[model samples]
Target: MERSSAHRTPGDPVAGMALPVYIVCGGTGGHLAPGIATAQRLIRAGISVELVVSEKEVDSRLLESYPDLNYRRVKGAPFRLSPKGLFLFVLHNTRSFISGFQYLRKNPPAMILAFGGFISVSYVIAAWLLKVPIVLHEANRVVGRSIRFLSGMADTVFLPDGVSLAGIEARRIRRLGMPLREEVKHVSKETIRREMDIPHHAKVLVVVGGSQGAKALNDWVEETHKSLASDGIWIILVTGPGKNQMPELKVLQSDMGVDVEIRTFAFHRSLHELFSCADVVLSRAGAGTVAELVCCLAPSILVPFPYAADDHQLANAQDLERRGGCIVIDQKNSSNLYREVLDLIFNDWLLGRMRQNLRRLNHGDAAENLTKQLIESYYPGHLRATAVENSTEAKEAVNG
Candidate 1:
């Protein structure tokens, strides 16, 4: 019952192939983090991992620690905006498609595991033509546009839950919660408070609006900093990129004498610490952020971005709201910020209720679950033994 290299077709790929190559992903941290977690699992189980990435936008340093990972550039892009933008985007996308095809034709992977993003789209098309088995992941509350277009082509499309994909035509979808790095599963609140130098008696509120700052939210917080700071609240605001008005906020903080903290960060990996320090998380509802908050059981005041594709952020926030886990505030209604923050923070009963509901949605071991699914779907035969072991582990995890 051993799988032979001669018979290593799409039906059976990962058996008897010495050092079968697993493609680790690198798109955004949202897409790439899950792939990294899975790659670490695969490597421990003795498989070779090759990282497919765009040499641009992603920090190669992020993948530097995993030297075992093979880094290869797949022509990737930022897509188009106007008519001229359309022409340029098409030109770049075509070149990417051609390069991806050539790469696959020369050096093939045992299986292609795609974590959906603009960069990963080229690989999906290449995998289709190469006859490689594919395992795709959709982490958002709604399947992304790229996943929707390629879902029919994948051997299996893995979802965070049914809430994320109700009308997509993909039938091979399985509900496996969003996989996260080892860090998300742990970090005591006291440890986080000590690291951030937060006072034990005050309520700690962490404000983040995706990787790039939410300017609207930041503006509102800046204007109302004194009033909130006077109410025994502490702020840890992550004002992204050039959006940090430190000179301005500092002046306001000094004049008002409010306990306000301003942080301007371009990149940060140790998010578990910040999440743990938080009593309430104020942020735009991105799928990746939502999963991490759920892991920490952080009560969220979700302000979904008004312009995300298919309004996916709104969908993400609404799904959590339905579970009674987080309160959804409209980004369009930043006028209500003061009222929303006050009502949630001062209301002890409301805070505890949210804590209980958010804790109910925590999927503590998503990384292991996702890795097992990819292996089972892509690997076959004597490896069916390993796959069976993986399935049993997944079932036990679900129950526990």
Candidate 2:
């Protein structure tokens, strides 16, 4: 891959003098978003970064917003034991390993910062072989397969509080929160409401089904939207790509003598706005989504994706619920979803408390703190001092 000057800021200390940090974050939005968030922080600190992502369409779509980010696409496939699954996994991973090795041999990175994903596996191994420092961040409470397999090779492993890997040394582990995109901020609800054309009096419910979308959640909305509409609720459903054949906005007169509006979209880019304006959100409890909800102070009813590896989503939801940030409903018991949403939406006191808890749970500077640690630990002498000073100033700015 050709080196691009686009990622370097005006005063980048090591703009053309040193190799850039390689961030292996792709496959799903959960992994990629946090990677981008950290990359942005590093760039602002005058550290160059190149993102390595999978060839998935979702990855491509999300990268559209970041036209200037230096990134490369690599083939990746999930690990499975079944015959065809294993065959494809080996085939794709081998290609990715070769691709990563060729590039890194020519232009070795200062370090490899990887968010757990299948796409990270190949590159992590290549970095390990090249003796490049590897830093792995696991957002979920239950560690992922990639992180678990690669943890021993990593110089440092970042994980959520109270979660631990059996054999990894305590010295190599750090308790760190998930990194959030800069766009995921707490904006004024009234301002967002006006921009989205939602009425001030409307009780807004936003449904998000992870990155590729949730079919079960979409079907639930389709089945019970009229009931919700009758209660004068405004619904914004993100149906995922190609999942919703008809995406339109509809305004209906509710039986309760109120105007109910429903908007359906295949995808929505401005999630921070959606979460900020929402009175309640129905979402899958992916670590990245949960982190965004906390940042936006959006109270939510979470349904963990039943098929998630090691049932990690359930672990994430449970942790949030333990902290009073959100409510968790098992997918098998989804028949209770409508009732739960209605009960929670109109409960102002409960919602307020949840928001407060979410605010307390919010670690707004995860990306900054993580970047600072990486700079202090892995960056070269002259560049490390400059980057550390810049990161400290940025942190002070945020706090000030």
Candidate 3:
């Protein structure tokens, strides 16, 4: 359960009491949501918060809801596809990292928390050099290149349940559960279904391509949808707006089996309604999205983005399957042919078992778990007393 952030105000003793600040580095909602949840927890505990983000949507649009937050647009996230691309990505990332180091000279945090993305790499590096406590989080089963590159730099690295950190030092790692939306944790299913306009009599299937839409996934849904729609199944497909919305989809809607509906826009922060109305979810295996599924106890058919970094998404799905909360479908396999997913959705037993298993994987308090750890790490008497003290002095140096 999450404590509300509304308690923080300017003059009230309960809200105005001076508390040491914490810095979070992330931009994308995948990373930012966990950071935001953690920050809210710290704030309610009477700590101040600062967010250092890349100059991207991950920060501005996602973190816009919190006005008291101190925001800084750092470097852009990196994308590397080839040898030359990798070199340039590293060079730019290093420059961003140096900038993060300089920021520490003025406004050092008690400790730094990261959701493991390009934007966080610099923050971790800067924290390490300044000898401030640093914690890094990986929301997936398989750690990505960013986490791998900087894991050694952080004082501790936390993961969502079920990940295997094979080569990393055991002393530095711990398995914390996934952070979930506070709203989703307390949401009323009855109200959510009403908001989504989902019918009560129908078993709902939600197909999500991602924030930018997956053409291949949408194409597959288009091919087998009519038959499922003809049955009693409600097929709600989210094509992810902007680029994926098809003018031709009107024809698909026109030729409807009467049970299919499609949508294109949804707030990234408040996606609980879609999950609430869904009996089954079909989506790519991004760590953040899969964590939301487990948090909601929503069983899903996982299709890893075939081209995701290091093929990490596929590995994330495999871990969920090992935990029995999901079924993995590799896009490369012919067995994953178009109708296969629709068939799985129709398999009442398969869907029921996955939903039942998902309950076991629910960490409903991942944010709480991590926030508690942050409090321990940042407290003056904790194991990281030196880091906390040094960080305080660094910030004082900046304030002076």
* lDDT tens digits, residue span 1-400, model 2: 1112343232344423376889999999999999999999999877889999999988998999999899999998999899999999999999999989889878878788999899898998887876666889999989999999999888789999899897888998999999987777888899999888888888999998988899999999989898999988999998888788444888877887888888998877778789999999999999998888998999999999999999999999999999998999999999999999999999999999999999888765899889888876665464647778889999999999
lDDT of 1 by residue, 1-400 (tens): 1122342355443433453554536556677777777777777665667767766543364565556666676656655688887786677668877887787778777777888777677777876776666677888888887887777666677876665454445566778777777656647777777776766656767788675567877787678766767765667677665677744233224334555554434445666667777788888888888888888878889999998888989999999999987899897787887888888877879888987888888755877876665555455443666678899999999999
Which candidate number maximizes TM-score? 2
Compute the lDDT for candidate 3: 0.67
TM-score of each: 0.84, 0.92, 0.80
Candidate with top lDDT is: 2
The runs of at least 3 residues in candidate 3 whose Cα sits more than 4 Å from the true structure, single-residue gaps closed, are: 1-23, 79-91, 161-169, 186-189, 222-228, 247-259, 266-268, 334-338, 380-400
**Considering lDDT, which of the candidate structures 1 and 2 is the better prediction for this target?**
2
Q: Quote the positional error of residue 131 for candidate 3 in Å.
A: 1.8
By TM-score, the better pick of 1 and 2 is 2
Residue 237 C-alpha lDDT in model 2: 93
